[model samples]
Target: MAQNTDGGNPFAEPGELDNPFQDPAVIQHRPSPQYATLDVYNPFETREPPSAYEPPAPAPLPPPSAPSQSSRKLSPTEPKNYGSYSSQASAAAATAELLKKQEELNRKAEELDRRERELQHAALGGKATRQNNWPPLPSFCPVQPCFFQDISMEIPQEFQKTVSTMYYLWMCSTLALLLNFLACLASFCVETNNGTGFGLSILWIILFTPCSFVCWYRPMYKAFRSDSSFNFFVFFFIFFAQDVLFVLQAIGIPGWGFSGWISALVVLRTNTAVAVIMLLVALLFTGIAVLGIVMLKRIHSLYRRTGASFQKAQQEFAAGVFSNPAVRTAAANAATGAAENAFRAP
Candidate 1:
């Protein structure tokens, strides 16, 4: 190149000769090239050193091993296995419940069997062998019980309540009759004219008590027990007569054995205490009449349901009469005598 006009270092790098600040002194004062290194400022390392009393950190765990083919296959079916287990548990519970019901049915069947056996035993003369508990008499008494009455044992489940009601009605009638006797006695004490009533009251009690029991009550009992049409008819006839008697007794006609409403009113003027007693007796009689009517209707309804009729009663009566051993023996003797007489005449 031509001799430079400006004064400049001839041995300098090509671009440094144009820059005056690129001197060695300035370059030395300038920052050195910062090369990136592996070291870095860590915030966790800046924390205080671990205390000597603290437990040491656990070592890093090893990586998990690869799953085997069998385990991998079973993993996908885990939910299905759980579902099958729940279904089996429910099935077991249902089976247990069914077993419990079967046990209950078996227990009921056994109870029924026991009842049937007892009934069969009772039917085969067991009832006759049992001692009579009704008309409960003291052992020292000379008179023994005439009948054995056990509504629960003798009557069917359907007829038990009806029979019990009739029995209670009979007891009430007996008590009323006793009260009537007392009232009549009281009336006689207050007025001499009532002597006839007092006298007749005794006879009525003696006559009506046993007769009513035998004729109407016994027939009703037998009718319900044996389903006998003849007994039912007898009960109806006698009970109707009893109903009429109740009405007559409730009417309280003068000089009648009963201390009825009319008699009570008549005695009211004579003695108030006697009148009160008589009125009570009269009301009892009236109630008996009403109850009798109701009971009659109930019995008739039951009879209708039983399919009993006059023809059935007649048939039963005829059959009963013909079945008598005494009647059969008499008939045989008569026939034999007639045959002998005919042969002798020939």
Candidate 2:
């Protein structure tokens, strides 16, 4: 009972009924993929169609699993979202690195700016460079849109005017001191028939003049040079000491070298008239000094505000302009063009 008579024929080209395993150590060899390259065939070139083999289809999904379940399969032709995930992650990391670098650069810039400001302060004797706030505003601007919007209704702060209230008042006081000295000379002339005689007090006026000039003027000049609030404060205190000395002198109080002097004796003897006049001058100076104090406070506030403004501008500039790659590229292009044009220009 044979399905075919091929077993009885040895040279029958081996019928389909033949047992391939019965061949003595011989087997049919598969067409190896090593012989394939781009579906080409030749001794030097062998290829196969790229579409010859396909990855298995995912088994028919079991009847829709519960909404909580999901599938994880890697079928050929299915996009590997991993690539997208990696790209997104790489982009995020690069952006973070860029931001960190930008922030670091901003920090360095701010530090440099602060150091420069400190150098300026030290060079100028620690005064703020900005001018005084003064000339109080009207309750409202006459025009609908005031040209000077940033300036307040309560104070004036024109950037160019360097004189503060204290400087102005000190200048006036210095002028008054000079006038008083001149008047004393005139009074001395009126008293001495020969205009050559010197009073015991003439020497005191001469001494006081230089001391007052030094006490206030030097510091005011330094304040102007530095434009600093710290210098103003120092100047105010030192000048206050000078003012106190004047008050004591005017009241004929004893003990500042002239306290027990022949000048004090003469001053006390004429205290009623001279003391009253000196007290009037002192009161006027007091009022001006109070005005200066107000201006100093206002300027200090503005100084702090300017620093804050610089910081804000730095942050916004870094975020909007410097951090943008497109902007950087454009800036680079512009710089290159400018350099090339400059070089070409004879």
Candidate 3:
């Protein structure tokens, strides 16, 4: 019995060899896949001291109790335990699936953000989201339809009088050129003491006349019709050119010569009265233009309500032109110059 005990174990107390079949009373235990041990304690347990205890005479061991069941070794028939391993593998697979879905969600969110930014940049309708903000344009325009269309294709408002004025100016310039040519013919046909005036008028026709067609009037037509920045710049340049030519004529009027400036003096020759008449016509044109701008203010509120640029709003209006009350009114007014009273016309 004494030899059967694990005497080397520090947790085994002395004199435990008598109960060789019983396990040692343990004080601590370790429950882990990597280790095996169990500990136990009993406060009520008492040990008899050697002096108080008497040794019992040894009884012959009953010929070992029938072979103990615990002595049998385990056989391969025992059920195999794969439950824990399979569960751990299933958990890992589920985590991988969850991560994949999370990544897919993140990618979709990024795509949405990209599209939103693009939409924000292209404020297609001259209308912006904010009251104070100018309509923001896309970096690049895809206006293929309007690329080569008529200059007046998309005007939201009318300036027919202004357009007509430009035409009249062009006609007058052409008539003046023809008159100068006839004057030359007349000087050659009849007896003129000094042909110098005819020659000077011819010079005026040559220098200042083509300008109305090629520079000033054409550019003005383009600017007003297109309402484009590039055309506006062209118009301004031509205006400055004409202004300079007129200024030089005003200064150099004394010398009657065939210079670009001298044709301007031809206006003075047409009679100071003709010059005054031209001035009044020009002033009337200016006043009508200013009045148009004032009217535009009332129209501006409608534009605010529409929240669209000229081209975009015009396209929409033309497509469903009269569906909106404001657009219907505008279209009617634009057809005739009398916008405020067009509906009341007899």
lDDT of 1: 0.84
Predicted candidate 2 versus true structure: per-residue lDDT over 87-133, tens digit per residue = 98998899999999998888667656655765775688644433332
Q: Tens digit of lDDT per residue, candidate 3, span 96-171?
A: 9999999888866765665454466456543243222112335475422212212232222344455555556556
Q: In model 2, what lDDT does residue 146 have? A: 16
Flag regions of model 3 displaced more than 4 Å: 1-157, 180-193, 243-346
lDDT (0 to 1) per candidate: 0.84, 0.50, 0.48
Instruction: Rank by lDDT, highest first.
Output: 1, 2, 3
The true-versus-predicted C-alpha distance at residue 46 of model 3, in Å, is 99
What is the per-residue lDDT of model 1 for residues 152-244, given as tens digits with 9 covering 90 to 100? Answer: 655666787898888888878888899999999999998998888899999999999888888999889888877899999999999999999
- Native-to-model Cα distance after best TM-score fit, residue 343 in candidate 2, in Å: 58
lDDT of 3 at 133: 16
RMSD of each: 14.7, 27.8, 26.3
List the candidates' TM-scores in order: 0.66, 0.27, 0.28
User: On TM-score, who's better, 1 or 3?
Assistant: 1
Query: What lDDT score is found at residue 157 in candidate 2?
Result: 29
Best prediction by TM-score: 1
